[model samples]
Each structure stands twice: as structure tokens, then as C-alpha cells.
Target: MGLLPLNYRRPDHVSEEDVRRNESSVEFDEKADASLKSGYSGTSPGIPDALTFDRILNGGACPPCTVRDFMNYLIYIEHAAENLQFYLWYRDYVRRFDAAPASETVLSPDWTRAMEEDTIARVQKDATGKAKKDAPVARELFKGTDFEKAPEARVESRDPFATPPRSSAGDTASLSGSQATSYVSQAEDAFSAVGVKQPFTIQPFRSEINRVIATYIVDDSPRQLNLSSCEQKAVVRALSYTTHPSALRTLSQNIENTLRRQAHPNFIRWSICNGNPARVTFARGLGVGTILVAAVGSIILTLSKAGRGWRALFAILWVLGIATLVAAAKGMCVVLHGLHHRNVRPWELFVEDNTTGLEQLHEGKRSFDSFGSCNSYEDEPWVVKYQRRFYVRKVFDREVWIQEPALRQIQDTIFLQSVLLALFGASALTAIFVAVPAGGFF
Candidate 1:
């Protein structure tokens, strides 16, 4: 809800278990966290890097990772995109519902009270602190809620896995349509409007709710979401009563959690194994390091006058080169790690705070900046997106310091692992070339 969230009136419509996870703070099992461990092989089924799913969801600095990028990965790679598609659509729908004119939103006496209360509560929570910083800056875009700082600003977790706290005792924004005239259109109708005025009230979004139900909630329907009957009914009932976004809230929350828990980790794994920075960075490191290794081998084989003692010294260069190559293979650049900094990807530029000078983050003809734009997924196709190399793209990447404690630990771990691997390789090579009585080329 921290991203200008859905109204958080406790759901009386569904079982408590269904909405239990929707609360503000999540109690994470410390042992289960993959980030706590830094020896990531990019081979774990669980995401083992410093980056967490909730962090990515909260718009953390995971490059080439965005709503669109994730969606494309889901659509093309995982073959499971319905949950994310419906979830995105639902959130976008909520924005329109909020931005709808107040006059048009007056569905009934009961609706007016609930909507007003929800508006006030949402604005109150989003008006200050870290949540407010990333919350929609366009307060003027919303209709009913006067964006004011609540004296005691209710802080919400940015974590999708975490549930927001229940509303106060007096927060009775929850209402049944019995308070309204109960104007419902029970007919096969299309709700195919993407523009602003589509989700207002009776004539506007009842059909859209029906459409969403027909598409995503109905069992075995095309693009059907894996929703429990209770969840589906809650959404149908709430949206039918009024096109308020809170209706879709439960369903969206579940879908969001699903995407975060399952699909996201798989995407990260695929990214590491296939591309992102793994192959590209590895190649760069390998090319440079291999040159040094070749030079060491050439000197050892060609210089017969050199004693075995000094021959072992040449292994030091091999160790350094192999370490660089190995580090990059593990998604770490040894040089960057030593410097305590990393290059920022173009897509990741906008993910930072305003203080990072991201006002002009999007510039190129292929910028993935504009959401709902025609060229959104053209940055790279998902089919071979991760397969993309960094040579041409490195110009877009800027050097940024790795300041986060967790990430710093991860980079250090990778560098150490790389050095250890290099030591082993160097020992083996020196044994064959220097320790053994193998004659030099000369």
C-alpha cells in the first residue's frame, strides 16, 4: 500500500487467513534470507544475492529489472504472465479510480463516506517519510483526497511480503451496497477502456469489474488468475458495489506475492546464468586476464635460462588474471570490487532517489522510461534480452559507488571467492610448468 496503496479496511468479506499476510510488517525468518549469505553461486533456487524480492518490488537498484522487464520475462521465459498482467492492470485501474472526478464517484451515500474515509487514510499514510518519498508526487492527480500530512503519519512497509497494519477502530470506510441504491448491471458487457474516465462509478467500471471477473477470476477462463473462490467473490462483490480499487486489493496482493516469491527468483537465476552481467562481464575479464596468462605461459615455455624458482614467480600474474576472470564469471568485477563501486545500467538509472540526478535518466530513442509507450519492450527482446553483450551498452553504464552494507558484503565475498579459485588454478599451472621436469620450448 505504500505505493499509494489500496484502502486497508480489514476485509470482512473474506476469511481472515486470506488477508492475514496483507498486514504492514512481515516477520521474516532470519535463517531463510538468501541475502544474509554472500557466497552466492547464482545456482541456488532461492535468490542468494544481496538483492531481495521485496527490495526489487519497492523499486530497488536491480538493473534491467522493472515492471515491464519482469513482465516480459514472465511472458516469454516463465510462460506464466497472467498473475503479473492482472496485477499491473489492477494497480493501473486503481490509479484511474482514484483520479476519477469526485462528482462521478458519488455512487451512493454509503459509497461517499467509505471513499472519503479511504482517501483521507491513504493520503495520511503517504504524506510523509520514506514511503512519501517514493509515493506518487502528483498529489494533484487524485480527486477526493486532500494530500495532507497526518500529525501522526502512518508508516507502511514497502515490502510486498509484509502486510500493512489494520486501520484504526473508527476507520469504518468499509461499507456494503445496502447503504447504496444497489444499482448493478447484470449483463455481458465490455469494460475495454484504457483512458482516464473508464473506472468512475455505475456506468463506468461495473462492466470493467465484470470483464475482469470474466477474464481473470472465472475458472479456466483465458488469462485466468489462480485465485481462491473467496478472493474472487470478494473482488466481484466489492467492485460490483462500487468501482473502488479496494475491491481488487486482496487479489492483487496475492498475485504480487506470487510474482515476488516464485517468478522473480527464477528471473534472477536466468539473468545470472544467461546474461545480465554474467557473460558480458565474464568475457571482458576473461579477455584481459587471458592475455596476462598467455604472456606468463609464453615466458615460462620460451625462457630456458630462467630457474624454476623465478618460474613460480610468473604464476603470480596468472593468479591475478585468473582471479579477474573468475570474479566476473561470478557477477563481480574484481577491479570494481577493489574500488568498492560498480557500473549502473541504463535502465537502473531512474530507480535511484531524486538526489542521484536522474532528472534526465531517459534520453535515447530506445529509453524504457515511458510506461505504456509503444517502444517499451524494445530495449532488448526477452527471447535474447539477457543474451545481450555489454560492449555497445557499456557507454550507457555509469560508475556508481556500492554504498549499501549488504551489497558491499556480497561484492567482497565474490572477490574473495574469485581470488581463492585463482590461487587453486595458479598452483595447478605452476606444478605442471615449474615443479615438473617439463622442458621449456627453447
Candidate 2:
């Protein structure tokens, strides 16, 4: 028999304190019944006679369904209105089943064991381990496993009008470039006949948005760089087929337009933060570099026989470089921040580490993906209290975080500061060389 969640249990012939301790649970159950009566029901047609958040999250004890199965259903539904029903059920279920608004409902050992066993069983069943990351998109906040690195089992093509495959041995033959070009022209003509001129548009990015503007906008196109067409297509495809298709399309068009204006290896830098390139310059970097070099040169000149004007120049540059380094370390680019104040939020940035940072790398492995947090999620857990009772909010309790960019922004901010500090150190060394006499070393 399935074990009942703590909230569903009643105070048998136990002490009054036991009942009082669980008073919030009774209130929640009543609220849940009221919610069901007042037009709140699970997304399914026939509402289960008894419904609870535990059932919605980890599957019902009655039907014995896991939360994983429920999520899988949502994935299949995609954008169907019925999926919205499931979303509502989850929201209501959480509000009603929680023992207290603030107290974190720790998963019982049996429940945790069940989930772990289920995960392992599912993994073992899939020969390719593809199902491991096949999590439902909604409530992606719960962390059982990181599906980001799941096996590349492609989604079955749903388009009914896909082109038929042609083999060389069959009636179809491989077309030369010229032949392919001719066919494309014919297809274009046919498309024109049907009044369709490639359903696409280039969305322009206003250069005044963020430093991304300076990073991506110049006077030439990115296609002229050594990047392959395949890379472009990959970026385009990811942008097009995102969960937020419309937003991705808009972002991609904006990126494409931005690329037409400049070429920067660091284009992805600004792109990652949804920042503009035209506004960001090496100036932030240059400021710190100048200060470091000047300070170092000044010290060297004091020891040597350098001229006054040159010494003053070195000192000024050194001070400026030091200030810039400090600013970057603190993520303070006042001018750029003011210009793109609305677009850029003060948060951490998540950058992937391939290797060479930790023991994981020494073990011949690397992570192409990483995540960050506002406050340490691992350190301080969030709980919602209901009427002086405590309950863990499921959204914060689970390990996985679905709000990807928001958390990553915070991490990135921390990383950006570190990088600026390093840049300052390098600038100081360079200044010492340029301003100080080389004879001192001899």
C-alpha cells in the first residue's frame, strides 16, 4: 500500500499537541475542498475525488502516478489549452496541500527513496539513457537530474509535409550545385506564385541598449568572419525552436541585425546578457589598464631618471587604470549602466566551464553548462509560513532551477568583477614595462 503524506494523516487517540502541531494541515484540507467546490479543479475532465499537492507533485497515492508522468503529459500537449489546466492544478495543489505557508515539508524517506528508485529504474529501462533528461518543461524548478546534458534523442519530426528521402540507386540523383541552385530558383518562383517570399525579417537592435551594442555593432557583417555557415544555422535553429518561439525569433532577428554592424569574438558575451554591443567599449577595461600602468610607471620613474611630464602621464594613467579595475570588479560601469539601465539587471552571470578549474576536470571531464543564484540556494532554503506554521515551498525546495537566465545573470555579475580585477593586474605590469627604464632589470 502507498504511504500517506504527513499532511493527510489525522491525530488519532494521540495527544492534543500532536493535533495542534498539525492544525495547519486541517485548515489546508478544508481550503482545498472549498477551492474544489468554488470552480478549482485538476486539468483533467473527471476531477479526482481527493486531490492534494503531494499528488500533483509526486503523483497520486490512489492512481500511483509520479509527478514525472504528469510532466510528460504536459510535454506531449506542448502548447495545448489542456496543458494550461495542468499548470493551474499544480498551482492550486501547492497552495492547498502545504502544511503551513512557511514550514518546509521535508520529503519523507520513503518518498525520497521511491523517487530515487523510480529515477534509476527509468534510467535503466532506457538503453540510451535518453529519458533521464526528458523532464516536463513546466515546474522545471524541481531538481532530480540535470536534463540539459541528456542524450541527443531528437524529437520525432511532427511536420506532415516533410520532403521525401531520395537515394542515388533510385530514380532520384544527387544534384550538382548549379542544378541545386536551379531547383531553388524554381522553388522560389513557385513560392512567389503562391505569394510567400520567405517568412522572415531582420529585427534591428537599437545600439543604445547595453554594452552588447558596442560589442556587436561596428560597420561590417559577422558572416565575413571565419565562422562556418553550419555555426550560423545552429544558432539560428536554437533561436527559432526555443520554448518561447516568438521571443526567440525576435531575439535572433535582433542578433542578426546587430551582427551586420560589427565583428567581435565577444559578441556572445553581450548576447548572453541580452545586452547591446555599441554601448560597451574597451573603455571600461582601458580605464583600469591606464591606472595600473601609470602607478607602476610612476614608482619606476621615481627610482630612475625619467622626465617630469612623462612621469605625470604615467601616474595619471596608472590611477585611472586602478579605478577602472575597481569599478569592473564591482560591476560599476556608470555611463553604460545609465544608458542601458532598463535592459541590464544587477544579477549574476552563468558561464560554462569546460575544464581546468576543479577536480572534475582533472578526472578527464568538463561541464559545458553552469548555473548561478541570487543568494546561495544551497545555503539558505526558502520556506513559506502559514498562520504561524512552517511549510516548504516546492518551487524552492527542489534542486532544479528553471528560471535559467535570471539566476545566471547573478553569477555572471560575480564573474565579470573577477575578470576586471585580473585585467587591472595585467595593465599594471604592462605600464611598468612602458614607463620604467629597461636598464633597471639589468
Candidate 3:
């Protein structure tokens, strides 16, 4: 009536051989544990000690990480730091430009005064339209004489005929052509005496003023983005012509506002969530799960006596699953698109389809010594092929790769995948229920 079987009884005494064997096993285990701990602490046979998760995460001074995990982490951190520095520099430059003394001239009184003076001069010149019109008559009358050399005193008395007073049109017309000629000559004399130059006009000052204003406006705006050297020179030249300080200050403020409103590059914000191994893994998992669910659902729907609606639903699920799987395989994280409000393709973030030129050489598609055999090929060792078959391409430039976006993209993709899985599960359950025979309600 013992709990243990009769044959399975404990030994009466411990054997020396058995004890020795047990002790040896314990010693071996201890040695193995020690070796493992040592391996983790220092470099292993092939793997470097510096390529640890801790060292990379902590940003410590470690050797080059050959492991993808640490390598990606380092790359991301380096790019992020660089971008941060650039962004800070740009922001500071903008601030300094705004605070600079030259920015105050746009709205200064000098600009207004210059504009007013130019306007008044133009109006005054325009008002002497009648005098300008009479120039032709004077030039014709004084055609033969050096009227320009008329003496300061005798110029007024040089004309013999005097202009008849305008009383009535009949009286004025009554004067003969000689009398009219005499009147014109007298008028010319009077004009010369008064030092009124022929072809009366004023020189243009607005063109120079306008040019200066344009230059100051350009100078006040951010120059680092896309403004060219030629454009900068033009702007400077324009500002040089400007005499108004108020106009310069106003233009400067306007430029500042424009720069502020512009979407300048942000390092920290742009670098978030990129080159994250966890994210890649998660994306892959979701993609695989979706594919499996879709496959199962499709198989069930095909074999079961389900209605057209259910079949169609399962078919759609299958297609969606396949699509998700492809995207995951390519490392295309759709969530990034949603969060960033932009299209973030998979190839931009990860190196995909990495292959060596060996295959091409073997197939006679490329030469063995060809340096640039592939479009993605680079001269660097790190840019080499992976697995002796796949050529790993470099990621996009840091500036192009990162973007400013909230972290919502992470949740968006996860949530979408979860919902899809749930639907698949529900469909499977419904199919199962429908297949079952209708028994009693109890």
C-alpha cells in the first residue's frame, strides 16, 4: 500500500563511484557557468567585448560594434548628436540675425524719408510738363545760335518779337507767322535768362532706392536654407542703395517672421524611433502573425460551407495578411507614415537585399575586378555584402532619414495589427460555430 512502486525503492547506501560522478558533474557545471560569465565580461573567441548592449545603450567609449544591434544603436546616436548640433547652430544664427543692429533699418525714418523725397521730386518734374512741351519751340527758334552760351544779362533782350497777350482767339490768331516766331524767340530768351535748362527733367532715384530695399529684405531672412550666393549678392546690393533705416528694420522683422514660420530641421525630433531593433522585430512578428491567421482563415473558408459574405471576408483578410507580410519583410513600417504625416518607405531605414558581386560574376553578369559592379555598392568594408550573397546597402542620409513626428506611429501600427488579428480570430470562431450541428438549446 506504499505510494511508490516496490521496484522503485531508494538505494540502501551511497556508492563511491556514484558520489564521484555527482561531484564531477557539479564541478563541470560550475566551470561552464564561470566560462560563460567570463565570456560576457570580456571578448569572446570571435565576438568583441565592446559589442555589448549595455556599452552601446550607455554611449560608453567602446570598440567598433560588429553586432547589428549595437551598430545600429551607435549609428543612430551619432546621427542624432550631429543633427542636434546643426539644429542648434541654425536656431542660434536665426536669433542673432534677428537681434543684430542692421535689422532695425527696415522700419527706420530714413527709408520713409527717401521714399518721400523720391516721390516729391518725381511729382515736381511731372508738374513741369508744360515747360517741357515748350522746349521744342525754343530749340527750333534758337537752332542757328549757341543759345546755350547766352550771356547772363543780355539773354532776355536777344528776342526782337514779344509774345502778344492772349485776350481773344481772334486777337492771338491775327498775329502773323513772323510775329509768332518772334514770340517764341522771346519766350526762349526768358527761359535761358532764368537758367531753365532745355529738355527739363529730373534723374530717377526710385530704382536705386527700390534695389536697396530688396537687398535688405533678403539679408534679413534666413540665408542657410536655400538662398544662393548670387541671390545674396543681389540682396546686399539692394540694401546698400537703401537710405531708409525704418524700411530695413521692417524688412528684417518680416524676414525673421518668415524664418520662424519655416520648417527648420530638428535633430532630436527627427531621430526618434529610427533604426530601432525592437520596432523591426515587432513589425516582423505582426506581419508573420497576420499571414498565418489569413492562411488559416482562407483554408477554413475554402473547405467550410460558409456563405459568400464569410468567404469574401476571409479572402480579404488573406490579401491584407499577405500585404502586411510583404511590408514587414521589407522593413516598411506603416506606422511611421501615419505618425510623421509623410511617406516613410522601408528601404529608407534598413539595408535590404544585400548581395555580393560574386553571384553576378559567376553568372557572367558582371566582371570580377569591377569596382562599381552594383548601384548600391560602396568602397567601404561595412558596405560589403552580407551572408556572402546579399549586398547590404547603406541607409538614407541622416537628414533625409529622420523627420519631426509624434511617437503615435508606433501605436498606430501595433493597434492596426492587433485589430486585424482579432478579426481573424472572430472569423475562425464564427466559422466553427456555423459548422457545428444545431443541437438542443440546453
Which residue segments of model 3 deviate by more than 4 Å?
Answer: 1-234, 238-293, 300-442
> What residue runs in model 2 are displaced by over 4 Å at the alpha carbon?
1-92, 98-278, 285-306, 329-331, 334-442
What TM-score, computed on C-alpha atoms, does each candidate reach?
Answer: 0.45, 0.23, 0.27
Q: Candidate 2, residues 61-93: lDDT per residue as tens digits?
A: 321122332322222221111222323332443
List runs of model 1 lying over 4 Å from the truth.
1-51, 55-188, 191-254, 266-303, 348-397, 438-441
User: Taking the tens digit of each residue's C-alpha lDDT, what string does model 1 give over 366-419?
Assistant: 222212222223343222432464555653355666544544554555566667
lDDT of 3 by residue, 110-179 (tens): 4454453454354345334534665576567777777744532332343333221122211211211222
**Looking at candidate 1, what is the lDDT of residue 239?**
50
Each prediction's whole-model lDDT (CA)? 0.48, 0.30, 0.34
lDDT of 1 at 155: 29
Span of ten consecutive residues with least summed lDDT in model 2: 366-375
Q: What is the lDDT of residue 391 in candidate 1?
A: 55
Ranking by lDDT: 1, 3, 2
Using TM-score as the measure, the top candidate is: 1
Error of 3 at 322 (Å): 8.2
